[model samples]
Target: MHEVKKDGILFHRFDHLGHCDRLCHGVFTRQGGVSAPPFDSLNVADGLGDAPAHVRENRQRILRATGGTDLMWMRQVHGTRVHIAEKGAATGTPVADALITAIPGLLLVVQVADCQPVLLYDPRRHIAAGVHSGWKGSVANILGRTVAGMISEFGCRPADILAGIGPSLGPCCAEFRHYQTELPEAFRSYKGPRSHFDFWAISVDQLCRAGLQKDNIEVQKVCTRCHDDRYFSYRAEKITGRFAAVIGLSPPQPT
Candidate 1:
């Protein structure tokens, strides 16, 4: 991933996705916005106890940075439900954990503090997806389900898709004390010392299993808990804000 600064706001872009002229993608950091400490600067999640006005301002800043006309956000229930975004269509926050779109100018956003935001782009079909995958979502195979949704709804071929796993809790800080009951047996292989699980690897493996090429996947590997100063981590700071990972197809350039 590459760091990009637009109008003083810092975000990261996946190199492969960045090269696609039709796509506008970014993983925003918790900086360059109007909000006090704790939720200070760029708190995009409205349900997190942050002031509505501050959250609105922070979202506008992101719109300025990404050039997205509309942002379709999910309620993120840590489930496998995927919402499809339409151009110029407005809707309330749906009770889902993932969003997919083929409409240009409509950004699919997934808010996260520590949960992984998996961005998927099908350059061939000009479709994109934003998935919010926490431990429950991961175990539920939300990543794979989103890919399948793309294939079914947008006629996308999984092999032609590129995935970017945004910053989240890393294995070093992901300790699952009651893993034997909480985590599935298949995830046992990723268990490390102190019962920490490598969710990054789990996401990669899940994406691959969904038919995405291994080389087409990009993992940020930046743990939100480890870099709490740069990001908002629920584990690091319980009463904190949420950052955003957004992806959308750009309108075709005028002739």
Candidate 2:
């Protein structure tokens, strides 16, 4: 991910998906906004009890910077339920962890502080999905279900899908005790005694097992907890803000 600065707004872009002119997606950092400390700048999530007005303004700033409207955000219960984006459907703040869509211009977003924001896109079917996969969500295999949902609903071939795993708490910073054991036993083969678990690798493995071509997957190696200066990290700061990973089909060209 390369940091981009224009018009006093700071954000980053995925190099692997750079070829997709039909898509406009970015994983934003915690910079270029009007919020105060803790929330800092560009905190997209209203989850931290920030003023609603401030959140709205920050959201507007992002939409303006990205040329997107009406961000299709979810309540994000960290479950595997996936929803198809609808333009006119009554969105009752669905409890799904993932949102899939072939519908253009309906930007799908997932908020995260230390959790992974996974974006899935099937260029062949013009389908896109945004998933919020934290430790619980990962153990529940939300990543696999998201890919499966995109295939089942939009007829997206796993081979044709491109997935990106955005910044989050890396294994270096994601520590858990053996007794409580938040991660499942399947991760034991990939674990170490004192070594923290790597959710990024777990997500990639899940995508691969779901039939997505390994070459089509891109993982941003940046660790949110390690780079607290650039991103917001819940692990780094007990009460912090969240950055957003957003994706949607490009709008039609004007005649």
Candidate 3:
């Protein structure tokens, strides 16, 4: 991942996606905004008890940094539902965990604190998706499901898709005390000392199982809980704001 500071706002761009001239994407950190502590600076989510005006301003800052004309965010219920982003879509948030779009200029976004924000792009088809996968969503195989959606809806081949797993809860801090009951047996192999699950590995495995080439996936591996200073961590702080992982197909450049 490459760190970029634009207009004083700091964010990250995956190397695989960064080289694509037709794409505009970012993994924004909680560094530049106007909100107070706990939700301090760059909190993009509107709910979660933050001031509405502050969230709006913060979102505007993000737009400026990403150069997106419009942003499409989901209600994010942690389910496998994937919404297709298109021009002139409805204003209300859709109740889904993933968003896919081929339309240029409509930025697809997923907000997260400790959950993994998986970004996928099919450079061949010029389509992109943003997925928000938490423990529940991971167990549900949201990453695989989103890839299937792209294949079905956009005729995108799995091998043509490039994926990036953004910073989230790493194994060092993802201790699941009641994994025997809370987590399924299939995830037992990922359990580490003291019951910490390596969700980053799990996401990569899910992507591969969905037919994506293993070499095409990039994992940021930057644990949010460990680096709470740069990102908001729900586990580390309990009360914190959400950062955004966004992707969009850029309009063609003038000749």
Per-residue accuracy of model 2 over 88-154 as CA lDDT, tens digit each: 7725567789998776677788899889998888877888899999988888999888888887777
What's the distance in Å from true for residue 164, model 3? 0.6
lDDT of model 3, residue 91: 58
How high is the lDDT of residue 187 in model 2? Answer: 86
Model 2 residue 24 distance off true place after TM-score fit, in angstroms: 1.2
In model 1, how large is the Cα lDDT of residue 109?
86
Q: The CA-based lDDT of model 1 is what?
A: 0.92
- Off by more than 4 A, model 1: 87-90, 252-255
- Model 2: which residue pairs collide? none
Task: For candidate 1, list the clashing residue pairs, or say none.
Answer: none
**Local accuracy by lDDT, each model:** 0.92, 0.82, 0.92
- TM-score quality measure for candidate 1: 0.97
What's the distance in Å from true for residue 46, model 2? 1.6
Total clashes, candidate 3? Answer: 0
Q: RMSD in angstroms, all models?
A: 1.1, 1.6, 1.2
lDDT of 3: 0.92
